[model samples]
Target: MARWEPHARQRLADAALELFAERGYEETTVLDIARRAGLAKSTFFRHFQDKRGVLFAEDAPAGPLVAAIAAAPAQAGPLDAVEYGLDALGRDVFTADRRPFTLRRRAVIEAHPDLREREALKEAGLTAAMGRAIAGRGVPGLAARVTAELGGLALKAAYERWSDPAGTEDFGDIARQTLDEIRSAVAEVRG
Candidate 1:
């Protein structure tokens, strides 16, 4: 049996990312990550199911996004509610200090097809959860689904821009701007 180690999860994640970047994802083994983190292999299993899980375990829950949406003003439109969720993500998850790690993680995922597929599935799950949250606010199903999809697009775009080494804007600000751009594009398409 393995006992809980302080900061074990974060240590393992950092070590895994470093290993993935250095040795390539396919070449990095779970035992290697455990050794890098100075934790027993059981500790790695305690935190994540596998090596790929190390990158994604922290985001396994959509709770923060859904909570932010639920906390939005009652009068807010579906997209506005979704924006609130994105803002929360910026404030809580994708802070400026995490940008470097995010860039490395994105690169690792992009380099591997399996990880890319998992990332896509994760995004789809997140969007589905967001749509459900919107519908809970009394939005129509179609409208909720549309808002969720648009929000997903905005999130991806904002993340890309924010991850740029030269970008200095906060994640929340970039996300709001990206959502606005998405809205404008949709309106133009409707014309």
Candidate 2:
């Protein structure tokens, strides 16, 4: 297959997952992944920087995620717009196609303290980006950050529920319940 084919990155992702599972994430090399996908090393490099790159796995959609939130109906509340962004992330970033690698990928991330630290930083970056997007929609500062934080937490909770084998609930349902909990908690604290 051509390296520049439309499905090439997906092919690479699949190969990386397989190799990560078979050899353990640390043992898997980018070359091994590319070779597994029946492509050259350049093809793997073209799709990702290295084996760890598969963990991030999102080559696109960054701009669009922020842009969608920024471009949401002006009348929408800040948290509502953030919810829209989180919903898009739920559907796109953490979907079934990517979940197959979750166990090993998360394991790799967990085992390395630095990787987990980086994950935290990434989450902060995502929140700040969402906050900026909300602020762009005319929402103010702390309010925007607060809304973004709740959105991120809602997404996190929804993902946790999604990861459960007994989790019969839908992502949207989980998000609603999680956010409602946050609302309740905040109200209780104020009271």
Candidate 3:
């Protein structure tokens, strides 16, 4: 067992991602990840429920983003609140320092069909959470659902842009731009 050290969760995550990249996600086991992290298997279990959990842990983004949405100013409309939430998540959770890890994780996820399905489920969960938050803010059910779905779509677009190696824009800027594009597309459909 490696010495009880700080950043154990981060170490486990880093090790998991590296191992998943090196050996493929399907072949990488929790024990392999723990060994690579210089930690015990128990330590891995302490931080994550399973190998997949290593990638989709509670600290990932969903909860924090939802909380941010819930905490947005009451006066803000549903879409504005979503933008605020995305901004908060971009600034606080998905900082530039995490970009490399995010890219690597995305690569691993995209390489696997099962992981892709799980990723879709995770995004759907986020959308549902956002819808609930918007509804809690006194928005009508259908409008809240639509706004949240649009926000989710914008988030996916922004994340793709942010993850692009050639892209230079900040996440918040990309998110806002994506939202604007979504709004414009909707306007075009309505006209």
lDDT of each: 0.88, 0.71, 0.87
Q: Lowest-scoring 10 consecutive residues by lDDT in candidate 2?
A: 56-65
User: Which digits, one per residue and each the tens of the lDDT, describe model 3 over residues 1-191?
Assistant: 53757899988899999999888998989989988988889988888899999778735677678788888888988999999889987888778888887888899999999999999998999888889988988999899999989998988889988988887778898898898899899899886
**C-alpha displacement of 36 in model 2, angstroms?**
2.5
List the candidate 1 regions with Cα displacement exceeding 4 Å: 1-5
Looking at candidate 2, what is the lDDT of residue 124?
76
Native-referenced Cα lDDT, model 2:
0.71
- Give the candidate number with the greatest lDDT: 1
In angstroms, the error of model 1 at 189 is: 1.4
> By the lDDT metric, which is better: model 1 or model 3?
1
TM-score of 2: 0.80
> In candidate 3, which residue pairs get closer than 3 Å at backbone N, Cα or C atoms, i.e. clash?
none
On residues 152-180, what C-alpha lDDT tens digit does candidate 1 reach at each position? 88888898999887899999999999999
* Candidate 2 backbone collisions, by pair: none
Candidate 2: segments with Cα more than 4 A from true spot:
1-6, 57-61, 102-104, 165-170
Q: Please rank every candidate by lDDT, starting with the best.
A: 1, 3, 2
